[model samples]
Structure formats: structure tokens, C-alpha cells
Target: MNETNDMAVARAARLDTATLSDALDRLGIVGQCHKIKGRDPEFRMAGRAFTLLCGPASTPPGTVGDFIDDVPPGAVIVIDNGGREDATIWGDILTEIAHRRGIAGTVIDGINRDVHLCRTLGYPVFSKDHWMRTGKDRVQVERTECVVNIGGARVAPGDLMRGDPDGVVVIPRAHEEAVLAAAEEIHAAEEHIREACRGGMRLDEARRQFKYHQLQTRQ
Candidate 1:
């Protein structure tokens, strides 16, 4: 990652999903990945998105993860399987390769399998859920390095993706600086409020002093 990208990732890692969501809301941006969640609440990831769109298999079916070989290090694999839950598009083999290659993480609008490997390897996998069923012969890759729908959010190649215990959010490449600025501001304000409360200031007074209620309101 370049210095700018590294800085963005670091800034995002310090802010939770809620703060980022509020930042997006303040900017009138739609970024929350609805219904998509982190498999392990303790795990967090931030990186540019490497998107893949999937659909029902063709007559002979198609590959699910051949694209892994091309994914750059530090890029989060964002897979859009049309929210299908019957099968999984990610598993142990992919997890191992991704980990070894220094890939940031994986997020799916559908599901994943062999979650044990993910947890054991300390790799982060965010998705709708997980199942043991395989996606092979059931799901096929439609396109790669393209815009893909994740939950209700549109994720494009190189878009910033951040996830934590709360969930995932995608920041458009064009809006990274603005979004990060907003989120950092919100985080600072929240920290001030917290410190005030800890120092014996009444919650209501502290919140009122900082205009807390308006922090997340559309601006």
C-alpha cells in the first residue's frame, strides 16, 4: 500500500463501524452493508476491494476462486453471490492462500464454508452467514474486478472496505478523503464526549455542549 492508502487504512482501523456509518450518514452517502456481518466479532479488516460477481452456474459450471491468484496483497476479496445461502463461495483452501499471500480479508453477500480454518488462521471473513455446502457446480463467477453489489451497497474495484464487530462499510474511491475526514471528526467528538462524562460532566450537558445529536444527522 502507498502512503496515502496506508494512512487511510490506519485511520479506518481506529474508527468502529458505527462511527464510519454515522460519517457516511452525515455526508448523505449510502455505504452500510445491510445484513452483512463479520463471522468473528473480534476481527477487523481494512483494505481496497477486489470485487467478484457471481451467478448460477452454466451447463458445465464455472470456477469459484480462480481469481484469487490475481488478487493483490492487502486487497479485500468482495464476493457478490446474489445473497445465496444454499452454498458457499469461500472455504479453507482459499483462506490459506489468501493468508499466505497477505490478502487483507474476505467479505461475501452470500455465505462461506470451513469457517474453522478462517478462525484458526486468524483470517477475517465477513458475510451473511456460513454453511457446509460447497459453491462448486452451484455458483459460478460472473465477472471480476468489476462493480458488485454487497448487501445493498455498490462496491467497485479499489473502493475502500472496512469491517469490524458491527459490520462492513464500503467507501467509494472518489470519496475516501472526505469520508475519512468525516469519520475522524466524529470519532474525535465522541472521544471528547466520553472523556467529559468520565470526568464527572453530566451526559446531557456534555452531549449538548458538543452538539452530539447533530453529529450523525444529514448535513
Candidate 2:
């Protein structure tokens, strides 16, 4: 809705992707960014999506990342490169610019290079993988601020994305409130179960008391 609302949602979705994934499953909503992984295992990110679609290079070979100038701060740059592993659509220069601009992070269906800068700056970049080959002549920007598929998840403008050591997950703008609520409930139940166990309750008893097994079951 607004920047304040987005930040609040982002903060609530801070739970690791695993917990959010369980919440999505419980709600029967598909938001997991399957096969996409963070470049650095410890890297973390959360922000609204600013999608970019990429296709095979055209006759004139369109630009690789001039769109950087247009991305708003606190928005994640989501690039859909058709999962091409041979060429990378992101690199150091873009990472530098994104970090300077306070952009949240970058997620790609393809690959990225110049990761040293990302690692150095703590600018999280998640993708299928990374490679040295540039996409300058192999791919081009097809569009921006439109829906794009990352990994297997469809991301639209303003959709919330959260990433961690586990992986990335997209919360459809329309489902953000529901997903966040579910995840919070699940997290609290888990904490209760742990506390019960620590207080000498049997693991099975704790789980049953907390409904641990059903936390992720489809409702």
C-alpha cells in the first residue's frame, strides 16, 4: 500500500524462508522460489519486488542494467533470465550501484557474476547460480515493473520477497497479510513446543500440545 506498510510487512516476514514456506503450504499458496539460492549462505534480504524480465539478445542487443537508475530504494531487483546458466545478468558494477542506492537486494532466475563485491558489501544476491560469462551479447532486458518468473515463482511489481540462508520466498502482494499471520502463528507454536520440551515435557507431548505436525498441513 505505502512504504510504511511495506516495511511493516517485510519486518513480519523476517522469519527464515523455511518457516514462511511452511506457512504458504498450510495456506495452499505457492510462493517459494524453488531452486534459487543466496550467493552467500548467511546473506539475508527482504523487500518489495521491482521485477525485470530478460530474453535472448535482440538484433541491437539491449542494455544489461541501465534499469538500476530507476529502481527505488528498499525494492528488490528480480530478474527473470529464463534460468540460463551460461550467461550472467548481474555483476559488480550493478551490485555497487544497487548498494549505493540502498536497493534491498537482487534475485535472478539466471545467474550473476562479480560476486566478490556483493559479498564484500553484504549486498545479498540470490539466483540459480553464478558464472563468469557476461550476458551483454547473450541476453537483453525485455521489460521492467512487470510480472516475471523467478525460479518457479511468479513475482509481480510490489510483491514482497524475503531471502535467507535457506533460500528466497515471494509473498504475493495480495497474500502478504495472510502469509505473515500464518507464519507468526506457526513460529509462536514452535517456540511453545520448545519451551515445553525444555521444561521436561516429552517431545511427543509438546508437539501434540502445540499442534506442531499440523502447523504446515493444508487448511
Candidate 3:
């Protein structure tokens, strides 16, 4: 697809995890939204994807920069750091460069640093925790462009990632169009349910009337 077409597709598909979760009930990929708690309660980022694979006690010097340099302007970086809370995989300096490049936000299955800086820079980052210690000592890149785990979800390079203060969700590239369609439907249904509740319908009655139970029954 051309740049314009790509942008349009991305725009249509981009959504916060809550919307996505409501839609694709079976596809929920869970992770803590630790980095966003004290900051903006709502956050959004749009892009295709560029994934990173890092591990505890593993990244080489310059690895983070090299990976960021290679990522395209409108791609999200999914960093898999094995959920290590001791070291931070991303920091203020990297956030600065990423913003300059117009890169989409980051999703780290690990910890991050410079939380205040990230918030000020308006960069969306989702992580498991926050720490002052850097990754320099405990983490290094074991592989790039390789499959990595984010809360048990197998994320690959080029997959679609949508994250917000709610959480993060990974949309496989092959199923992007289908998943987005589902997410849209899910969001609409949720709105309908919300309206019902506001109209004084009982919670269980509204849920049942809206077929909310079906959301969990998808095979």
C-alpha cells in the first residue's frame, strides 16, 4: 500500500485496548499499564509495527539506538524484555530520539525510566514497571526481528500494535483487517450497552439484552 493508503488503514485500525477487548474477547493479551498510571489517563498511538527482543543481562551497547534508527517513522516498537523489573529498557534519551523520528509509542514487557520525561514528551509507553536503574548492566539485545513474548502473546515484527492507558493488544498482520472490523463492532455494542444502563436498565438485564455473554463465547 502507498503511504496514504497505509495511513488510512492505520487510522481505521488504531484503537485502545478496551475497545479491542470488548470486540475480540478471545484475543485479549494482558499486561500492566504501569507507565501511565500517574500521567494522562487516556493515551493513544497509531502505527504498523517494529518489534524488539531484549532480555535480562543481555543488550549490547548501541543496540537500542541501532534498532530505533532502523524503525520506520510510523511503526510501533514492541520491546520484549522478559518482564524484568530490575532494569529499564527505555529512557529519556531514547524517547527523545524516537519522538524526533516521528516513531509511534513503545510497549515494553519490562520496566522503563524517565517516566516524567516520557509524559512531558507526549510519548506513549506501556510497561510492567518503572525503575531508576538502567538496563546497561542487566539487559542486552539477544536478538532483533525475532519473535518475543509479551504477557504470553507471541509478537512478531510487522504486526499491528494498539495501546493506551487501558493496556496493549497485538494484531497479527495477517489478521489486521478482520480484527479491526471486529473491534469496531465491539465498540458499537459497548456503546449500546452503556446507553441501556444509563436508561435505567438493570445491569444483568442490559448485559443479557446486549448479548454481552456472547463476547466470552467466541471460539
Candidate 4:
């Protein structure tokens, strides 16, 4: 049977961004989003991506896109704002609507505002930083469903996004299976190393037994 999106998300949720990043590194995939972090340390999310691209405002700053309703439930809104720190592309109203809609989460290449609401709603938002300036006149939404960059990572529509307190990782649609399998193997090996250490084995011994040093080495 074909793997459904829900199944993919479920699998992704079982792994953190650290393990996923290692998998990506091992597979020679540049999937790790750099310098992006959760709005709240407790937040975590996983889902397919719904990408958007934004740019500096020309005549007037741009308004938030009316694309929320079209975003499927459990989808992560991936917005690329060119890593601008002066303006925010997301805020309170969007957070409330997204929470109610059951959207998996949002990840921005830049920043966001009104973060208190995000914390209150427990909505997962990963971005470079948060600010008070609005993007209305500072930035504009250029397009939707297009490939965009988040942090330093390329994010395409329908790609899998997994995030946690550590950070976010984007798994390309074509490489999801391989990335996931690699991440699972890495996670299991790490777990075994921990288990051995807890059973009175030396830390270095457990790592050697699991070949942990070579786990993330590119094949």
C-alpha cells in the first residue's frame, strides 16, 4: 500500500531534528534548517509542507496571504522571507486561526511577532527570531506552493517538516523514505549505546560497540 501523509507524519514525530539532521548528513542531503528555533522550548510538530515565498515590499508592504483556508489540516506552513530580521511575517491572528484549523505548525526563514499568543495556544512556530515590527509594509507575500528556503535549507511543497526544541529539519518528498530509515537506524543505535552505558558499561565502550562514531558518516 502507498504510504499516506498521516503515516509519514506519524513516523517523523517519532524522531527529533537532531537525528534527522544526522540522517540527512549521512545521505548527503542538506535538509537541516540552520539558526531557526521554536517560539517556545516545549513546542514540537510534524507534517507535510505548504510553502510560501515572501520578499521586501515595493510600493506598499504586503499583507498576509489568504491561503490559510486552502492549507490542509496537519500541514506545516513554510514561509521564506529571505531571513529578514526587521519584519515579522506571522503573528497572533494567524496563530489563532492555525491552531483552530489543526494546522501542524509553521516555520519561517525570518521572524515572527505576537509570540505570546503562540505560547498560549501551544502552536509550534520555528523561526530565526521574533520581533514587533509588522511585515505589512516591510515585506510581501510573493507566491504560494513554491519551493522556498527556510533558514539555510530548501523547502519544497509537500515536503515533510519535523521540528522540536532543538530545531527543524525538512525531508524532501523524494528522499523521505531513505531519510526516515536512516534516522531510525541512527536513533536506535544511539538508544542502544545509552542502554549499554546505563548497564555499567563504559561510555566509550558502548559507543564503540554500536559503532556510534560511524553512524552519521556519509556512505
TM of each candidate vs. truth: 0.98, 0.97, 0.82, 0.96
Task: Judging by TM-score, tell me the better candidate of 2 and 4.
Answer: 2
Off by over 4 Å in 1: none
Give the Cα lDDT of each candidate: 0.93, 0.90, 0.70, 0.92
Q: After superposition, how far is residue 70 of candidate 1 from its true place, in Å?
A: 0.4
Error of 3 at 207 (Å): 3.4
Residue-by-residue lDDT tens digits, candidate 4, 1-219: 136767878999999999999999999999989999998999999999999999988775556757789898889999999999998999998999999999999999999999999999999999999999988877888999999998788999999999999999999989999999999999999999989988999999999999999998999
The segments of candidate 2 whose C-alpha lies over 4 angstroms from its true place after superposition are: 1-4
Clashes of 3: 5
The list of candidate 4 runs beyond 4 A from truth reads 1-3
Weakest 10 consecutive residues of candidate 2 by summed lDDT:
5-14
Provide the RMSD of all predictions against the true structure, rounded to 1 decimal.
Answer: 0.9, 1.2, 3.4, 1.5
Put down candidate 1 lDDT per residue, 28-120, tens digits, no spaces. 888999999988878799999999999999999989989999999999999999999999999999999999999999999999999888998
Q: Write the per-residue lDDT of candidate 3 for residues 51-134, one digit (tens) a residue.
A: 778855533454444577887887777888888888789998888999889887887888888988878888887777788998
Give the 10-residue window scoring lowest on summed lDDT in candidate 4: 1-10
- Model 3 CA deviation exceeding 4 Å by range: 1-14, 27-40, 56-62, 196-205
